[model samples]
Target: MQKTLSTLTNNWAPSSLSQKVFLAQQVREHEAAAAQPCGFSMYMLMQRAGRGVFGHLKATYPYAHNILVLVGVGNNAGDGYVVATLAKSFGWQVTVAALNPHKVLSGDADTAQQAWIAEGGTIRPWQDIDFKNFDVIVDGILGTGLKGQVRKDASELICALNKTDLPVLSIDVPSGLDSDTGVPLGICVHADCTVTLVAKKQGMHTGQGKTYTGKLIYDDLDIALTFNKIAQPSAYLVSYDQLPKLEKRQANAHKGNFGRLLTLGANAGMPGSLRLTSEAALRTGAALVRAYCHTDSRLSISIGRPELMLTSDGLSAQLAWSTCLAIGPGLGTDKWATKLFNETMAHIESEQKTCVIDADGLNLLAESQHAFSTIFSPKHCVITPHPGEAARLLGCDVPDIEQDRLKAAQSLAKHYNAVCVLKGAGSIISNGEQSWICTDGNPGMATAGMGDTLTGIIAALLAQGMSATDAALYGVCLHGAAADIIAQQYGQRGMLASDLFEPLRVLVNPT
Candidate 1:
């Protein structure tokens, strides 16, 4: 089964996720700062946090009679203790597994442990219990403080937990997860759901974070508003709701009222990629859509999709006539591709026309980095690159790119002087100074031709008179939203790029 968190209800999503995402350290520092102003002690905050977890557990897993709580040395264990204590009072079977020796617990965690004991709750060593006895596992072993590889014993326990099919609810951040990077240190708990406190950690929404953190539920512990005031967010998560709708057209509007766009690709043998892109532009309501392809591929492209105005002659002329240019779909990195890439760059530089770059087009640009420095401008260009392409553009490995996707995207924007779209789980749209994270897309979108389709959407939006920033922002959201609609209908297993075309039409013309 695909590892995805099903959006069960509107309640599954946090009502206030639009606020900036804080890093693991930021949440810790800010929570303390925010709590001190109200004279709230760590112990008091722990009580509120534990109560929050207990409330959510009762609401979500009402039928669960046996709960296995994993306790650590940190205050995260305190939250687990509170949950166990409450569960015992509710007359449910509760077992506390102490992954860390209970004697090491101090401060608020010690107080929490004493409270659990006061309620007749006994702690068991990690190895002493059989996991099958429990219906649910409460992971509170590690929080955001984890770094490096997980210890051997904890790693074994995590692996053992993964072997079982029981639903695991993680407290704070999952144990063995790098709350800053969303990457597992060496081993990480694969949670069925994660209850984050204070604010959502920025890492939990990107990279491997999504796979590890299932249905993400946030509890501010009632300190979010005050905490957010003192701790500036690392980045803001953006949604389509925050975007402005496209202005309606007049009754007398014609093709010219929208925008004309020229798509350059379909070099030799590759007609499908350019066709998907050109048709996507048409679907997005671009008035006049044209495709410039190799002489060999031109006939198939024309016969396959007559809606596009196909041309082999006047490459520079087409670039000048069109209001926006989308290049790189099926664009191979050969001498012929180089000629076209250079010519398109020259035209955009001279005319200052808006442009979108994707696929092998990014590869060609990566090859001539120094030459592009003089020509590329952020005001008119947007480059979409998946992780592999982004690595090439940034001259780093894919892991380096994934290690910090937000930074990679922002770096690409700054380095290329263009709006950069580092496409992945939470596609980051950046123009260096400002950034927005799109959280709409699903894992099924990991298909071929997806990037090509995105290029067409962004270019079409730009042609329709949106600013480069707005075009990039709206285009990414629209593309993802359309994909989501298709995933829902077709079950995402055999989803094709064309599945998004009809949905794109309906979404872009939002009434």
Candidate 2:
């Protein structure tokens, strides 16, 4: 039997709703086919979309009586018309401002437009309207089909709407924003709230998308299950709920059972980075953490952390003793740092041990001429690189890396044959076959030593027997969630990297 929309949604799991993310093309191409399984046509889907937006707006702004619906020549305009018709029916003062007042819409869009006109709704050119007179603006100027830069007329209309202080509600997607990459095509509508239909787009949850898409509300329209069955998601959006839980310790479990992590770095003048990494590893439940640094760094790195086994000699012995390795926190590119890095890489490759390479280690690897496969195996290696380091490793510019972070992370993982955590606003974790975006961090985590702390956390998870991909996924989400907790309490400014330790510990041992 064909299930009803309410029946499907009632059984939908919250975790699945929040976590699955798809590409713009996937949704555009598959939505109609997906709707069919639920006995809905494209026009029926459009009607539901319009109804959802209007219902949400009514609930959100109970007193908002006057509204301006700005629309362009596309299916998006059809959605706007539907909203306008619904508003007029409800006795609210509504105006439909068309970017092209004379242009005709077709198919499902045409049906929606005709219905609005039949209901005695009028359409005016967008330029003729005074935006200040309206209580709210409904943005239906463009949809997910947006290609390249926005045209001048549409761009000017979007700019005018943005200039207004009145709240704006966007349907499908904020016009001018790339639904796939989350980047703006020149200028995008800065909506106060966006009601995205169908499945969640990857772009909406990351990068500049977050800035443009204010409070996001998803209406699957009861077809997400059918859509998901037809298409695989580009990436999963991970949060605290999706993190891998650590197994409870046995009463007889000893320190050795938890695993040891060896963290290398802190050459001469840069002791704090090493300290942050080593301490983070400890806080993340590494049974024992050993810090191998330059002789001058030993005292400073171990000053407050007596539990850390510090050493300046016997690199081979330290590497042998630890279950996993985290390299590159304060590791410089000088000859001494290079020698240690090379030796460690050689040891890791030869022993086939699990490892994390971050910061300077990534920088050094970028400089190395050796093939990535010769140095690291995908099964046991994870690389965490911010945009700058990722650009260096990928031989590209920072803008190029940020252009499509998902692609950049996947490229790094494929090129290096290891799990890649491309760190930034939606830190991406990709292992070629699967990808995830960490949606928990804040801008406050931009401070120094943050990457170092992340390196330690991932290393600890790896040492404790998580797979390379699982460790990176869990570590990145945990790192960001911890930062969010701190930002809520202390605010983002002046938030130190070390501030995450308490929350990190608390989060990893989730109740």
- Clash totals for all models, in order? 0, 0
> Model 1: what TM-score?
0.94
Candidate 2: segments with Cα more than 4 A from true spot: 1-18
Q: How well does each candidate superpose onto the true structure, as a TM-score?
A: 0.94, 0.94
Q: Which tens-of-lDDT digit does each residue in 107-209 have in candidate 1?
A: 8888999999999888889889899888899998888887679988789889988888899999988888887778889999999889989887877888788
How many pairs of residues collide in model 1? 0
Poorly placed runs, candidate 1 (over 4 Å): 1-18, 36-39, 369-371
lDDT of 2 at 122: 87
lDDT (C-alpha) at residue 491 in model 1? 77
The window of 10 residues in a row where model 1 has the poorest summed lDDT is 3-12
Error of 1 at 346 (Å): 1.4
